[model samples]
Target: MMNDIAKMQELWQEMSSWMTTYMKSFYSPEAAKTAKSHLEIKSAKTIFFDDAQIVDGIILKEKHTWKVVKNCENLAKHLNLNEHDSLLAKMIGLFHDVGRFYQFTVYRTFNDALSENHAKLGLKVIKDLPFMAKLDEEDLATLKFAIGNHNAKEIAPTENQRHLAFAKLIRDADKIDIYRVLKPFLGPTDGTGCSPDFVDLFVAGKQCDYTKMRTQDDRKLVRLMWVYDVYFAWSLKQIVEQNYIEDIINNLVQDEKMMQGITRLRNYIQEKLQTKDIWQG
Candidate 1:
């Protein structure tokens, strides 16, 4: 039998491989020249930050996911049985940001300021493809259910362990990557020294300049903090086992308030490690 694991890998590869090709072929050379000639704006940023941003975000999301996959594989081996569930965990990590490609290609914006949820966009990408057809309904359900809900209020109802597992993989992998990347500020970042009131309002936790309570960019930062907010022993274990807390604390820059926030989360992590982290995770 091919088994679920092989099938899951095939599905993930199918999406990733197509995504790579699409990013290249999306705007053909003639289209690029003609489009540029048509709408070239002198004031517009060269290489729209949005474009690089999503690309980098997806790239980072994938990189972080690979770390989770490695850890999950090691975890599965330690738990000592083999099947596709571990691979499923890895696949979840990979697709959690799979929508960014389309969101960028279609909207030229990842900010949601451009108006579309990446999660929703991701589902569109999954549904349009030959690869999505390959998975059985169970795997397909896990794909959307996990990816869509990765940023959702609940990863899944507690009863759906298989669905829940995929979500957890995305959460851990995404946070681990973010913390490792953003944690290292030598001093207070000072809100990049300067421009918009948006940063000021955000760090202060006041109403933002933007209409949405939180923008896509803001949500990314908020989600980073929410990593500390995760519940579940396996998730907690993954946090410590992955060293996300250390990554954040070691590079912390303090605003008195931000410092307090970091301090609190650090204590919470310590408690989870000492009192609650004994499981196989």
Candidate 2:
């Protein structure tokens, strides 16, 4: 048993050495400046496509992944992030929903309550990938934290500013694309009004608990409440410029309280749009 354990440890060290040497040659010093051409990004894309192929009728979700990556690139550019940071941001977007493919294939549902939390599943997938070993320790941690929190109600508390910043970036990028994905599904509620608790949350400018969604109107209100959670002015601008807010509002069963929430949201959006986004990172 001791000899077998010694052999296993030796093999593991050899594999780690070979991986280190391979990655040093695979990634150039300038790789971050050309993130799209980076081998790890290519590997991530390959994993995404392979996973996507397992689930048959989710073309929309596949397309949503591409758009979310683009949104992340554009948002990074808007923030004037350096090349290394930009690459990290783009990587976060590319892998943010990596678990969704597996979730849908196995569970046949996108609902986290019905299936599993895609973000947490995504972290497991990421950690298992060999390409992730090429990333610097800090970069790898940031990537995990950002992707882990992408679908979460709120980002988990952290003092690591870089992790928090990248998390916010991925969240905004994901939400921006989500509005487009959900566009076709927006319509009048099924005559069942919004739940009283959900309405109270909306009026208070708070995000609704998605699990508590009891009606179609509750779903619509939840999306509207996402605007309050949006962290960046640039993201808010994209949402408003695309008329996503207006479209949802048009479909909602607008009681006086709903309208009050809408008014507050609109006011907040206008103010956010006028404010310049200065990157402290």
Q: What's the lDDT for all of these models?
A: 0.54, 0.76
Question: Can you give the lDDT of residue 131 in candidate 2?
Answer: 59
lDDT of 2 at 10: 51
**187-209 in candidate 1: lDDT tens per residue?**
23334332235334434433332
The deviation in Å at residue 218 for candidate 1 is 8.2
Give a tens-digit lDDT track for model 2, residues 1-281. Answer: 46544543454444334332322232233432343422333322222223433433244465677688789989999999976677667677777887776677667678999989999888876677665776668988998999988888999999998888889999999999998888877786678888999888888989877977888888889999999988889999999999999999999888898899999989988998988886655
Cα TM-score of candidate 2:
0.80
lDDT of model number 1: 0.54
lDDT of 2 at 62: 53
